[model samples]
Target: MKNVLILGANGQIARIVAKRLLSEQADVQLTLYLRKSHRVDDLVAINSARVRTVDADIHDQEALDKAVQGQDIVFISNVDHDPDNELTQGVITAMIKNDVKRVIASNVLGIYGEVPGEYGRWNTEMLTQAGLNRARRSDELLEKSGLDYTTLRLPWLNDRDEVKYSITHKGESYVGVSGSRQSMADVVVKMIADPTYLNRESIGLADPDTQGLTRPVY
Candidate 1:
């Protein structure tokens, strides 16, 4: 049974990933880490022996240390506003101290300006430029952390339930405009179950059928 720790358990993607893990891997153990305990009351209400919730700030050394201990994989999903990459560093430090070696993290596309055409231009111009740069630095830290890691660069996210997606490597340009959160969650589970493409590579994910400047044709 694999032990999994989700750092940002309250977010939509993390919540979906947790459910998928529970449904797909019955023997797996889950540790959901969140800042607010009440945010995941529904998860706790499940009352399964395999599910555990930890309430702590991801940057708190003692708390993070306790969370990562005895975990086989650490999934980082920081939705909080971190412009300095501090949260990413904290996760790495805790993982190192706990001897946990595998990580799968969510990042934004165009960190390297790999998304081509007008779509790339629109995303770069209208989105959080500062946040993109900060995420790039965070990605750099993960690359040099000496631990097995996979960074997923995501496009504009929607809450659709579709699971279709396409992948592109670090240097390769992005394929489509929008990707569903469900597809991203599915990819995270895939990385956890099989680390065949691990080791600090950045992957861009998009729904193959969706193409436009923004989502919902607006």
Candidate 2:
């Protein structure tokens, strides 16, 4: 069985991805790591044999290392809010220690100033310069970490159940200002199922139809 460790497992997108994996990928086992293990009691109850929970802060290096051990992939659904990017760095350290090479991380759009026009200005205003810089630093650290990684730069997210999204590469301007959380979860599930997909790439995701909106779709 392929073991997948999901950090920030209680997050909305991560929860969706976990449920999808449980239903669609019978060959996969999950290690759900979150600060509050009780938040995932339902998942563990669903399949205790295939699902495990780790309740510890990501900064707990020993716990993080233990969780990463023997996992085929690590999915980070949380953003590092630390100004020093300590959270991302900690995950990288743990993955390296455990020799886990595959990772998929979530980030926000406008990190590279890739959004354009009025929407871009609005996004910048929303995130503020400091927030954008922190995200950029996280992506930069991932690029230099030498792990097989895919950084997903997501736009404003909504609860829409539909899974429709378009992708743009690193240097390309971001398309659309918002997308569904389901779309983001779908992309993560795809990458988990196929390790070679989008390896070592940082890409943007959004619903193409949401493009050019001065405000977020939420």
Candidate 3:
């Protein structure tokens, strides 16, 4: 069984990914890292045996290191305001110490504020600025650390009354260029299955009438 560690166990999407992985694959072990020890409603479908939760903050190096031990893949889905967000830095170190090779980090667009379009309008101006800035800083720090990383930049996310949607990589411009919008579930599926996206690249996502990798190629 491949052991996978997910940071931010209570995140909207991480729960989805855990089930998809266990359901889709036969042999898998899931460890969820969280600051608090709490059971989430989203994890109901999954068996308590396959899923284990740990109370550890990534900023705490020793606790994080213990949580990351013996895991093959680490998914970082934490977004909180910590001084320099040692969480991102902790991932890099944990991977090195544990000999884990694959890492998927969640980083959104406009961290540099270089790309802006449709998505920007949806966000309250200042709120968008601070959010993207943190994502950008997280990405920058992770990339320089020599860790194999995949950074997914998601657009406006919606779970209300929507059928399905499409995702675009780093390609064409859309009405919502501010960033992409993808379902927490859908995004998790793509990341785990697609190894081509394994190292050091940012993906922009969206929810549309069409679904999966739909921006007409980069």
Candidate 4:
């Protein structure tokens, strides 16, 4: 059995991904640490023996370290209004302590201009300057930590129905401010399936070309 640790697991995207993981393979066990008590009835309904939930602060190094023990894969979904960037740093330290090698982290697109042009620049600035320099600093530390990790630079997410999206590689030119966006579920699938993504690399995702969007691609 593969032990999976999911930070911010109560989130919409995280919950969606957890369900898919359950559907894909029962051998995957999910340990979700949530800061808030999200009263999602479906979460309680869907979780049986495969998924476990715990209320803990990612900022607490002792608690974080405890959570990291005996996990094969770790997913760090961003916390809303996460002030101190504790999760990012705590994840890295915890992983090192636990000897966990595979980490999948979510950051916003445009941090490095994976999406190019003015709009992409705007997007990057918006996230980077959104009152969380600690997050950026934490990410920088994670990149240099020398662990097998994948940093997903996700695009604007929409809660639409299931749809496949495109993965934006480094050096790609993002169109100016026009795109339908990727459903959160698809991004999670892409991240979990691709084990090759690592500390030095990032991938930006959006609706695939086959879906045919009316707006420009960014």
Which candidate number would show the highest lDDT if scored against the true structure?
A: 2
Deviation of model 2 at 145, angstroms: 0.7
Per-residue error for 132 in candidate 2, Å, reads 0.6
Give per-residue CA lDDT, model 3, range 1-218, as digits (tens).
Answer: 77888898777677667777778865678888887666653463467767788887667788888988988778887653444666777778878888887788876544554344433444426446666667677777766767777777655454453325444444544323322222645655665666445356655555443223322211
How many clashing residue pairs are found in candidate 3? 8
- As a TM-score, model 3 comes out at 0.78
Sort by TM-score, top down from the best: 2, 1, 4, 3
Model 4 TM: 0.79
Give the residue spans of candidate 1 off by over 4 A: 79-81, 197-199, 212-218
lDDT of candidates 1 onward, in order: 0.82, 0.94, 0.64, 0.65
lDDT of 4 by residue, 30-121 (tens): 88887764544466567667777767876778888888899888888773236756667778889998898888777665555445545554
List residue ranges in candidate 4 displaced over 4 A: 36-41, 79-84, 128-138, 174-183, 190-194, 197-200, 208-218
lDDT of 4: 0.65
Q: After TM-score superposition, what is the CA distance of residue 176 in candidate 2 from its true location, in Å?
A: 0.7
TM-score of candidate 1 versus the correct structure, residues matched by position: 0.92
Candidate 3 local distance difference test against the native: 0.64
RMSD of 3: 5.1
Q: Assess every candidate by TM-score.
A: 0.92, 0.98, 0.78, 0.79
Error of 4 at 196 (Å): 3.8
